[model samples]
Target chain A: MQFTSERRLDGAVREREFALGEIPGILWTPGSVSAPAPLILLGPPPLGLRKTYPRLVARARHSAAAGFATATIELPGRGDRPRWPAAEQALAELRRAMEAGEPVSDEIVDALILPLVDRAVPEWQAALDALLSLREIGGPVGYSGGVISIGTRLAVVEPRISAAVLFAGSFVPRAMFQEARQVTIPLHVLLQWDDEGNDRQAALDLFDAFGSKEKTLHANMGGHTGVPQFAGDAAAQFFTRHLK
Target chain B: MQFTSERRLDGAVREREFALGEIPGILWTPGSVSAPAPLILLGPPPLGLRKTYPRLVARARHSAAAGFATATIELPGRGDRPRWPAAEQALAELRRAMEAGEPVSDEIVDALILPLVDRAVPEWQAALDALLSLREIGGPVGYSGGVISIGTRLAVVEPRISAAVLFAGSFVPRAMFQEARQVTIPLHVLLQWDDEGNDRQAALDLFDAFGSKEKTLHANMGGHTGVPQFAGDAAAQFFTRHLK
Candidate 1:
């Protein structure tokens, strides 16, 4: 599965310069699309796991096969080769924009690094807005993030999206959860039992908090990277349930 | 987080003479009883991760805190300390019981390999049954197991349990999913993005089949052991949702 990137300009979809909020990113989209369909906004892990995107791409292909337009965005912070300065700068810009009451330019913020920051509310909001824009293409809209990205997405975007999926994410600060009174959409969380960083109870508490009447929680039986199969299926189901 | 094994059944609960169909396991209860209680049913990995149950007890203590009861069972095939013949013999007995369509005796199984297998399923079930039988128990039941034990539990007992959690488990054969039809309770599945053993999609598809309207899918950031923080939250939320 290969990802080809493009942009929508003047009501016409065209190839646009791929920039992850001023930081560089490898924008990936399906090479072929038959129609205007739902879009998937993929937020990859910000660590050095570029080879990992193939799995994400595989999931995107599944989404495309199911009749949705899909895209996997390599955030500025994480990919085969990451530019740390760009990511740090983006974070600073986000903080300044939020503090100065200015409209943040998502294209200028690093999507991958957004998760690593301890306080990423503004960055999270910017990422959410970018995802929402993609949703305007008219099918279903979905986002998948690793750890910090997933946590921020769940904290900021879960309520707005049709369906959201998180892989190995922890509870946002207790304050973020307290701030989120309820989540109305279907949310799915996947975690490992032996995960040393984000233990099982933390995941369950977040699920309990954001899980709507339609949420579901699944615990697979492996170590950190044991459940690629389930993650793919979750992406498909989330898209199918909402976008289809 | 202290785990002390006892050959003498002085502090044990529900201790009884060996009977038919029982599996050997440890019975761990919290020292204090006033706080929210937690019970961990430890099922270790099939191979390569030695001394699985002891590790689980240590990990669970960190999350379950002091008020919880944790039990680790020995798998039928592995974990025989002092190299007891009972471990292998118990498997033979289990196979016979399965072939004969007889109810497995929990007590007999427990006595035979209590010191041998730690984190096996049959042993886990015996421990769970024992915990539930207690009058002082008013908390949640959490489970952790290896690939085989996890699939076995999902195929055999997931529906019967109120809350179930798994780590890096493989797909429960399609035949089993077809046979089971649905899982009504809350399930937490945690897996890595690049797990080699199981087909991630197949497992998620199975969960999709059984998962309740409320479910969660989390993709951890690390390859094998990404985010450890989520584990604790997942346990707490799962127990709270199912136990309370």
Candidate 2:
């Protein structure tokens, strides 16, 4: 893993760009890491790790100011990664189906979701490995968004993720729901009530399925992008309470 | 609402075929309806309403033999209904994306699923309306098969359905998971542990998310189509207890 162009930011926080294989990311840390600070692995929406996710940057800064290290990586097919032309074509085809009000087949649904899940999980594991290895970060790790399935996979397969704040911006593959039962970590999931493209019922169901005895759902009435800034603050508080 | 080609079977079960608008279905009732018998509305999987779903036929037969009238309707894309060309195109696109390891956007995911949910729910409600309208069938209704989202919707919106047997053979849209919390009816969910196309975790999660206090999950070790014949018998027994 290599981190370059380190820059000092306001509040004595440090920032750097990182890359480990195809996984590109950014890391943030408090000015004085005299001791190991709690760490958070941030996941992004489908937009991946771009400036488009301002909330991510703000959340990371908040964590740093609160004395924790945070990091987020570009999911495959986003950022500097190569886009799968076939997947793009699939998206186009799906759009046509939607326009024409078509009934999708099971094979199609599997094709759209499974490959992404398979590629993302291992990359997340590697990213987590790289983040935790940083001397400035400590145990009691937390994970926040990308697509929910990545978090779901991390929660199930990565025992190190002690807590998670899942964003209900994506669909839950049916298989992942079953995997969710294995995730007994503390969780804070957020949902926007009127997200146009979102399946509101599925979000509620995923929250209900959480195996975490301490899971809480923070639902706000808004569109997909309408999550208020306060929700992020609340998530920060949650991290402070648990990760700290 | 028209019925044609009525037939009587060896077990004193009476069968009838019907067509209403674009929906086509079959109804089965016990030989004698001395009293109001509980009714079950079986939903077809992607395989549609064919001999392919022998389990469905068997379940309906079991229900009929047990003195309950049972029925099943073809999903919009299956059986006598014409396949939605747009939906098929979407499937092909999804296949390409999977083969090329492409990332699917949330909008594409929604397109792939929402249309089906929209089309299937109304058809299910219609089927319920038609079946209950039949003098041979009476109170205490049940639902089984197809993708789980249909069952989730029926459980929430259709107050007359007293119970449901959901098969974990399909994906759970994230929105449907939220709607699941509204379901308060008795439920008997079935799952095959090694369903190839299924994300096993998602099925378990959907089950855990169900809000019903009177719900049971019958999980067996098998493939997607490997639900043991006895599991159907168990589901029949569950219907007997709940629907009867």
Candidate 3:
């Protein structure tokens, strides 16, 4: 079940069409495949990055060159599709979670928040499950990880997520982080000194609560978008070390 | 009349009280004051730094110590008793200006947006007018200026504003740098590398449109809040050089 890079009509850069159950995806591999090489299932930001930015393409290329199978799959309701009404749905779910005093686990949070991702969670899950199923068809899948920005980080803390490299992403309240502490995984945070939209310090404060030795921090040189190169490199290295 | 350090309050800083003209503000003079020092009114951000953040208070204090009569005036819809729906009003005005296809002047923009600055502009203007009306007021009331942040910058481009210092603010498209170029007054922009909510590069790109000699750019090390200290010092210097 080897994947090859080719242009797909879906407008994905170097896409390989595949299906997880009935959910279809384009497996976009960046470079040459080799043994013990990691596979990066990139979860895009809330407004999917594939159509809006070219940096994702650059990241996939770089990661593939580093002996990784990078797939930049399309999330539902993004890219020439009718956009999901995320703001209203997210606010409603946030209110519900707050009222219920429910511990916001990855699954619970995703179930409650997928509609807000601007691409439904079930679709994302289907794509993810499809990517995971590739492990059984092929050989051992060494790594499973993602990089999220701004609002996109909300979906990356899932139990299935092996490791994450977050960039100026928002964090749940202190209570939510505290409740989900047991499910902690290795996380690397790249924070900017003066980022206002996302409080870099607040995110750091939340990361500190993880209390896991696996966490690492890299302060970026510029604001939000400046870290694409840094994130791509760090993510590849992290995948190599942990996933391999 | 020389003014001395009076008092500092520590708590959730009151934006409405300041707006209602309840905060005690001082008039400073180099010698026995004869005329009002040309006023440079600054409109604080919608989210008051002093109220919510300690770092902002320290920065404000530093600016006050630097010889300017500094006040953090509240924007509308943000302080305790808001006079206007801040963001909504601002956005509506912006849309109107854009649709009209006319360049926004400082007065025109201010007239449309001042309700959004809450009572900050009027309070400062009242104080300045009173001080200038004094018989003993010695100095020539030759200039009026301001520093605008976020939405308030739209007000600074008024023809009457002899000088201005803008930080992490955006322009109203066509109005962009037209005010800066047309106004004979000097303008200094203290921009953050990565402003949280605003488009940093887009704002910076407007600088090129300004008449080169009339404008100066200070790319300092901070996010939005991080700018107050660095920007305050630079602004104080800018005011001294131009406003005085």
Q: For candidate 3, write residues A1-244 as lDDT tens digits.
A: 3344356323433456554443334565533343433456655654564453466556666665666665545455545445456544654675676578764444444543434443444465555556666542222232222323212333234445566565545434434455335535565555654444355545555555554445554443345555534335545666665555
Per-residue lDDT tens digits of candidate 2, residues A63-154?
Answer: 88888898887877777798897666655675676678775444554566667788888887888888888778888899986688888888
Candidate 1 C-alpha lDDT tens digits along B52-168:
544554555554453556555445555443345765576578568757877556643454334332334445555556566666554456554455335434435643355556564
| Candidate 1 i-RMS | 10.6
Q: Could you tell me the interface RMSD of model 2?
A: 13.7
Q: Taking the tens digit of each residue's C-alpha lDDT, what string does model 1 give over A141-238?
A: 66555553444445454455566666654324554455334555555666665554354555556655663545545555556666645446544665
TM-score of chain B of each: 0.62, 0.90, 0.57
Of 1 and 3, the candidate ahead on TM-score is: 1
Model 2 segments beyond 4 Å from truth? Answer: A51-53, A97-109, B1-244
| Alpha carbon lDDT at B14, candidate 3 | 19
Positional deviation of B62 in candidate 3, in angstroms? 44
What local lDDT score does residue B203 receive in model 2, on the 0 to 100 scale? 76
Interface Cα RMSD, each model: 10.6, 13.7, 13.2
**For model 3, what is the error of residue B73's alpha carbon versus the real structure, in angstroms, after optimal superposition?**
53
Error of 3 at B216 (Å): 28
Residue pairs clashing, model 3: A194-B223, A197-B196, B34-B136, B34-B137, B34-B138, B35-B137, B35-B138, B35-B139, B106-B157, B106-B158
lDDT by residue (tens digit), candidate 2, B1-244: 6886798877588888787776777888888888877888877777777755566667667788888887777777676678887777766776676677775444555556678888988887877787777776789888877778888988899888888888887766778789988889977777775676666778767876888866655555557887755567657767777776
lDDT against true structure, model 2: 0.76
Off by over 4 Å in 1: A1-17, A26-34, A48-51, A74-136, A148-160, A170-172, A179-181, A228-231, B1-244
